[model samples]
Target chain A: MKMTPKAVVIGSLLVLAAVVFVAVILPYADTNQTVPSEIFRSRVSEEAAGRLIYIQNGCVYCHSQSIRKVDWGLGADRIAQAGDYVEDHPILLGSARTGPDLSQAGGEHPDDWHIAHFINPRYTRPVSIMPAFEFLGMDRVATLTSYVQSLGLKAADRRMERQRFWKQEAIKAYEAGPEANVRWLNENVPQGWRDVPNPYPTTEAGLARGHVIYQNFCLGCHGPVGDGMGPAQPWIYPPPLNFTILKGREVSGGVLYYQIMNGITGTAMPYFKRELESQKIWEVGDYVAVYFINQSDANSEPRGIDAAWEP
Target chain B: MSNPSPTYQTAKGFCLTSAFWMIVGTLMGLIGATELVAPDLTKNIGWLVFGRVRPIHINIVLFGFVTPGLLAAAFYYFPRLLKTELYSERLGVVTVVAWNIALVAVVLTLMLGYTQGREYAELIWPIDVAVIVVFLMVFFNFIMTVKQRTEPVLYVSVWYALAAVILTACTYALGNIVWRPSSGALVGIPDAIILWFYGHNVFGLLLTPLSAGVTYYVIPRSVRAPLYSHTLSLLGFWSLIVVYTHIGTHHLLQVPVPTWLKVIAIVDSVAMVIPVMAFLINIWYTAKGRLGEIHADIGAKFVFTGTIMYFFVSIQGSMMSLPDVQRVTHFNNWVVAHAHIGVLGFAGMIALGGLYYILPKVTGRPLYSRLLADIQYWLVLIVSIGFTVVLTIAGLIQGNGWLNGETVYRILPQIHPYYVTRASLGLILVIGAALGFYNIVRTLFVRSGEAVT
Candidate 1:
């Protein structure tokens, strides 16, 4: 096993070339994803710059940029495809998920939520293990938010458009006092949903479990007192639904269950079906029915199939 | 070149402690895996929650167990190969104790629910500091031993061992953000970026280097050949550091971070195959003509298997880093598949191999039973492969189900079967760990041990 300098040098060069080919050359040959020109794609240069920051910081470790057919029931709007990343050079598909996916993150929240999340995850999500990007500076943070907002591409543009439209309306109603704001929010809920009565029973155990679920999942959005003014409310446009608004209304178990499970997609109320179970949904709905709405039809007629454990 | 004979007693002491940690850590892994299947099976105790126990299992195996176990073997062999006795076995023992103390703190905090909640970085700031101290101590001991070496030439293994300790120490400090006791973070998105960079590096650079170091030492030594190519070895070493360092950002591609940074991460992640394949080719080639020789020695057999696992993990890791591939794998058991393959499959195998290789030399006695070690090895290999398969399927089911807009409840029945299978496979690993503990104890403590001859 005699070692020769020539063989050694040749081996080193081969490995070196291989590294260079993949790291530099391959990326150049690949088609890079860019914003579409057809859809009012005004590329916020700042957001584009922030996308670079996202790339640099490894935020993809915890977040994802692609939604799929599996995500629709989880309240996702669209599934990702090759066309979505047509302009991406080194597509931002990340591994390791210490956090949630963000493919359709645009218009999910206002720029303020992005800012808060980027600065420190804990401020937005009490249990967030996603680290803060504040060290990257406000300029960089702004760029990263822009990139996050651009995740869904054309779909994101549409959502952002909706968000912008509703944001103006929300602000106006918010400025007009709580009564007017509640009225505006209820007006947005389809009449059927507004009339739907709670169907599940409000058992003590169910309410207890619901309290825990609410704290873990909903408290961050709907405040402890059922006021929409949760920590994330400021950053959320049409802020979280003030649960109190539904008080004495005809809100039902099915409606609350649907809202909680499906999430008002164009709004900040994310679907919980993917993260929570059926029992959890039913329990949380019951909790809101008894505690927040102050009126519930949970245990009334047409109670569906009574769960095995229920009396 | 020799002073008054140093007793093998010091080396013996470190070996015993290391073997203990290795066995305990593996048991923890078994428990953690089982818990995933039957969440409420363990009395629903807060201390044993998957959230708490999983991290403890991982941390103990990585820090308390594998690192020390491998370092014990490294310390014993590094000095001998360099024609010098260890600079201070006492310091090595102290580091071992400190590491165990850190493990104790980690388990306690996790059980008490005092976690930062980040995957792998669960320990609070104080424990974080303890970890840094332990790493620094280990590094200082290794460096001083190298300085005191009688051998003029530094081997490739020496370089890897040195780089592992030094780089890991720095990464730990920066990743933990030891300065911020309350939060251990920067204010926002930048912090997530920094945290994962350090997190992935823990596996990518630190564990990778240490395992590779042992592989380099074992392959040639067992095959009775000079290293195939020292220059290639060094090249692989440096390239690993370069590519692995930046690829951590690949973990954050989906975030609001800069696209350019994401580009670097994705590209580097793909480029990772270069260093990965290079090392694999070099090692596999070195062992090519001597497969019989490798099989003949039980120690080399384990080490060889470890190298193969390393190949699987690295390839899987690279693929998992791809955005397209991540669409299916991220946030699912697929990454968990990668984690177990990397930690338990690759690093765990390497640590065990190092321990077995050095045990006879350190104890002056043969293994209690070659058959037992062989059985243990097969058990670990088969079970881990099964784990990889079962967990990957579960992750896929979850990923695809969620992506399809299917309700989470709908997918439960589909995924439960895989969970059961994974738990069953985990039991095999647990059995192997227990058997390993018995074997090591017999070899170390039992007198008149049976010899291969």
Candidate 2:
């Protein structure tokens, strides 16, 4: 093939045409062919507006919208179907997970929790490296929260329902009195969990590590002094748990671990299972028992797992 | 002879402009990297926010730095290889001025947050239109020069340059959705498919071919040898056009894009090996035994290293398209590493090489300081290698951590040091960009040497 301008232009155009056909034209033609999945639905105007805000703020740089089958090990609730993104313009299936996958973020926390976290991630997560979005203003923050809470579409609605039901009960208990609220919070724990003592013994190093973990994961709402009056307290209703209320109470390591692991529904508490490891949860729980609650049961008999580091 | 009407002035203008922008562009990148390490580093500064800075870095690097540098060489060679004066030096200078103005507009508008919010296509419609006009102007000048060519047969370099301009003009217009002018996008998933098609092709069609063209021209001349295989070079060119076009969808494989589109992307991504190898083999064979001579010329040294980086990135790109590999590689710093290798290592290196090769010819002067150029080269090489190592390691940690159900914040502590390292290396690259600008400026306007007639 002698190099000629005509040949080069023609060949380049042909290749472009082929790509446009295969990648763009055909896929666009079949776009309407995608049926909405069970969990897929159109976004309301507010969510759609919030989606624009999310895009503007470049949230997609940190969070991914699509979850895959390979993500099953990551505790993904559902594999993303193409239909799930049918209504998304420029579908923000982000290219980095600098933050957790937000595909199922709806009802992950109350709107108040989201508001406080957005104002400053460090308030909710002391170790968080996510940029503070407080500059988006309170109204824009609320709009962004709406978009985030609607991530899972129809499935997100069900989770939001559970959060709403729990929220009303929690508020009622909180309004009654600290004694009634503590009882209500403890009653949610199973009998087996309430009776189980901390298996790990308390040490200076352990308590120090626990303190760090508490600051990163719990201090936002639980307060620096464990009084449930941290910066986020203003926003979160049924506020964070005051560890002092657990003093002279029948609180055990298992009870604290369960609540931290699963998070309290209808409240601002978020599940720590995704963020903290087994040892971290136990350590933070022990730190709470020893410091704010002025009690310690971590040295009790039948310690759960033998500490390999302990002599 | 009355100074020949400053025949290469347009090329000189673009060369200086490109070098100047490389410094600004790399500094933007450094700031973005610093903010990644400390998100509060630029809190409440909308103009300097990571989101805004990121696009600025990308746009400036693509248009301001790499493209103009390559075009600098193109403007020089188009007249020389065609055995004619440029169609109009006046028109060429006008285009260069317009190009810089458009770049300025790109920066100001993006900083002001008037973006369309699409990755790679973020420029608002007005700047988009300005970009198209500049490309059109270049196409007009070049095509007219080609029409007036005293030489009958067009070289491969001419074809590549012409195609890059005309094709990108069309691609930019279509990709930016110039018709709508408001959203700059189609309504849904279809828009993603088109945007990435344009996105990947911006590199595949524009930078790849331009760099290849400059390499094709510089290597043989620097080594003072004939091309190893003109036939092979043309084959690589055509095959690149065909295969590279369809691989954009590979970025969307995990998403819910059509299955057939994904398959085509993967298949074509692997097929990219053919053209990539063809170009490398031809170039290496041409420089086969003349490596000492190539090293004697600083320009060919950068060009040759770029070719080697091209081989590594191309192979890595093909493998990354696989579903299993992507499970661990996608949505992580691994891809970021890949981008650095492709853009800075491969294309940016060649752009610099192209500028260096043409500088003496255009200015009739040896470089102001060869030592500084050499230092800049090493700095770029070392920093790019450091970036690939640190970012790839961070990516693997993040990918494997996510696979193991570890939380994103938990992985942050593990990768924090790497982020610090990346920012530190970024400082080195910014210094290199500054050194390159200083070297080019002095070589062009300051230094005096024997005049070429």
Candidate 3:
């Protein structure tokens, strides 16, 4: 290896060219052949514009659209496919999950939830570290929401339909007066859940733990006094429920648990089943029952079994 | 040591450019880290948002801070090694001016949200071209210097410096997809393949080799010894280019990229130990029984510590590429920690080392303050290690929490403490950058009454 200027420059250049062919050219040949996935469709102009905003804002750095088989978060139902990104100029299969994967994020919530979320993620997600995008203004925020809603493509559309339907139902119930709203809320719970009481006996520790969960997950939307006057109240429609109205209106512990776990879909309320375990749901439900509703069905009548941990 | 010329205008220009940008780059990092702790700190300031600030921080550190620092050392050494003067001092100065202009454009466009949206490759087509053109300018100047060399045997540092500039020029154009001005990306998954290929190479070819060039040049001279092994140098240089170029796909291992490509990236990533150990062994052995000399020189100390960081980061990289380990590390702050170690701890440390090593020689003056230089070194070293430890813990908490079905939202509160600690450390790093700039400017510009060599 006689060291020469020619050898160093030309030799390294040749190595780079060859590697680019194999690592870059060959893989491009293989992956570029993929057709559209079933959920894949060309974005509408609005969605495309929103994609630009997403790009501009650098959302891809934190919110990944790429879902792996090992993932247990949102969009875990569908493993990402090469076909899924056939139309993306620069596929936004993001590298980090600082936030949830937006692959199937479209239709996960109604557009209203997204709007409120974009303005200040803390409004809807009290614990969110995502920066407030209120500076993007209402129009850009709406556009950004559309792009997020278009994440799962056709799969997202189906979810959107469900959200719209639920949104209408929720608004109608709210307009029907507090009695009707409480009745509709509890009526929606499965009969078995409606009959079941909070399984764990309520204790001071449980309430304290439940208080922490409330502040972390609910206080932003539901308000400090649980009157649904939280900061996000102005943005959300059929706004976060006014818990005081549910008092003495057949709001059982099970109804509270069911509502918390399943969430009032179509509104800004997101399902907690993905995040909260059964105990957390029960605890938070108990907290709401005792503190907000001034009612308690916990550890009373038809209780199946006492948990060992109860003190 | 030899002074081929009385004036080193190009080296001085680059030394100043590196020092100035280091503060801006570290400040951006501090902003991004602070946002993680207090998302509402910036409130409605859209331009200061996390997404935009993050890329600006990364690009500036890579191109603005680290590259120029290494180039400053290269400019000083190229002429010294060749036993001749630089080919064109005027051309070298113009490149410095153009490089700073491009860096300004990088900050402005990204702040205004003019980006291609790809990490590491985020600069739009125009900035990308500017980057390549400037790199070409550097390569042309160096190669011309090589052509007119009085010395027959080209030093190992010369090889690395030349290869890094040329290879980065080509890779920058290719990865950025300079042909496609509208998007600067390929369609579909291939876009990801190309992006990581270019992304990993940014570190693999650009930073690693440039840092290696500085390390190879500075250490042996500081220790007053010939290289421990010519065979090891040959083995290290060629193996680095070969193995590093193949492993960029390791970033896409968890993605929907082809299985065969993933296999290649994994195997090559693991095989990367060959080049890494070769370089480290060569340098460590060269410095053997010469700890006192290395310690006495502020520059050699930083470079040597950088080698230790490189060893940790590279080993961590190899292990991380494993599918099982990636299940926990990928797409999280563990990778962030790994990156901090590689860029800030390894290459960044070496860049400062090279800059410090050449500062007095370029200016023909003593350092403005030895104590201040030592303080900057300690601040940087502490910040890098602190970031790695804090971010890795946060990443593990997130990764493990997610694996057991904990939502990202549920775990935010748990990691807030670590994020706070990271931001606190980032503040120290910014202070370090500011102190370094102050030290460098004073050393280069201040008229001191002290004796001049």
Judged by DockQ, which candidate is best? 3
Q: Candidate 1: list runs displaced more than 4 Å.
A: A1-311, B1-14, B448-453
What is the TM-score ranking, best to worst? 3, 2, 1
- The per-model lDDT (C-alpha) reads 0.69, 0.86, 0.91
lDDT of 2 by residue, A1-311 (tens): 77677777766777777767777888889875678899988899899889888877667777888887777423287888877877777677777887778898998888888988888787777777777788888999999999988989998888899999999999999999988888888899998888888778899999999998887788888888999888888877877888898887778888889999989889988887867888999999999999999898896966666768674
Q: How do all the candidates rank in terms of lDDT, highest first? A: 3, 2, 1
Candidate 3 chain A weakest ten by summed lDDT: A302-311
Q: Which digits, one per residue and each the tens of the lDDT, describe model 2 over residues B362-398?
A: 8777888788889998998998788889999999998
TM-score of structure candidate 2: 0.95
Q: Top lDDT: which candidate number? A: 3
The Cα error of candidate 1 at residue B200, in Å, is: 1.0
Interface RMSD of each: 11.1, 2.0, 0.7
lDDT of 3 by residue, A121-214 (tens): 8888888999999999999999989999998999999999999999999999999988888888888999998888887788999999999999
TM-score, one value per model:
0.65, 0.95, 0.99
Native contact recovery (fnat) for each candidate is 0.11, 0.55, 0.89
Q: DockQ of each model against the real complex?
A: 0.08, 0.59, 0.89
After TM-score superposition, the amount by which residue B291's alpha carbon in candidate 2 deviates from its true location, in angstroms, is 1.6
Q: CA lDDT of A156 in candidate 2?
A: 89
Residue A174's lDDT in candidate 1: 74
Candidate with more favorable, higher lDDT: 2 or 3: 3
